[model samples]
Target: MTLPFYLRGLLLLTLIGCGWLLWQDTSDDLDSAPTAVVARPTEPAAPPSPVAATASVVDLFPAQTWTPAPPPTPVDTSPPKPPPLPFTVSAQWRFENQSKIVVLHGNGNQYTLCNRCSIPGRIVPGKMLDAHYRLDKLTDTTVVLTYMPLKHASTLRLDTH
Candidate 1:
């Protein structure tokens, strides 16, 4: 025969409940509990040191003193003795194609000609032959004396003190 429907239902339900409880219990048991830990002690130390000295020192006295310098003065150039030769005599007559003349007779009797002789006026010394025909006399320096004329063949040199 068969259980009445209601009862069957109840039974099924109870079984299911019990199965679930059992599964729960097993799962709980599998989870582990925590463990506790204890302590330990440690160690120490070290030391080292010292180094010194780097040196410098200097001093010695002596600073400058000394003197000497002086000498220079002497000068007289020598060339101012040439003004006296303004003519103690001077003469130059040249012609060989005619033209080269200088006639100066100084010492205050003054005569001059340097325009190449054809002497006609302005060459004193009694107008010297109206200017040239003979005035030969060269070099007599107490400061200049010179002359020339040998038919006008020019070139004469004389140096009588």
Candidate 2:
């Protein structure tokens, strides 16, 4: 005969919810509503959803088909680096024995380098630590070299001795 308040509200809500499907967070709703024995459809049941509308308002407009464009790909923009040198270069407490020289020992030659000066590239191993970057500064465990053209700097970390 007549629906209970919650059942009538549920039916009214079901009618309203179909129109607002895109804006509703209906994730918490129960899959099926509790049915009463006399609760039968007066007319044919409303189409289940906007997406599945057979003769509902959704059918009044052209079929809505949307395909999102693919995202753009990324490009890498970096210069290739040279291999690392393996020579032993030291600027420890002996940097200023008498003439502020840092010792480079390898490649059958020993270079006595001073701060703010560069090597000649002949004796540097693998040439990773290029002669272009001057021996700018030195400490017990590291050497700082400045690349003149770009003012870019590089480091040579020495193994503990």
Q: Which ten residues in a row have the lowest lDDT in candidate 2?
A: 121-130
lDDT of 1: 0.46
**Model 1: how far is 46 from its true place, Å?**
37
How do the predictions measure up, each by TM-score? 0.21, 0.32
Best by TM-score: 2
Give per-residue CA lDDT, model 1, range 1-161, as digits (tens).
Answer: 99999999999999999999999998887775445667454644433222222223233564656655446666788633312233433655455755444554554555654433556654422223322233433222211222223233222343432
- For candidate 2, the TM-score is 0.32
> Taking the tens digit of each residue's C-alpha lDDT, what string does model 2 give over 49-80?
85556555453576656987679887777755
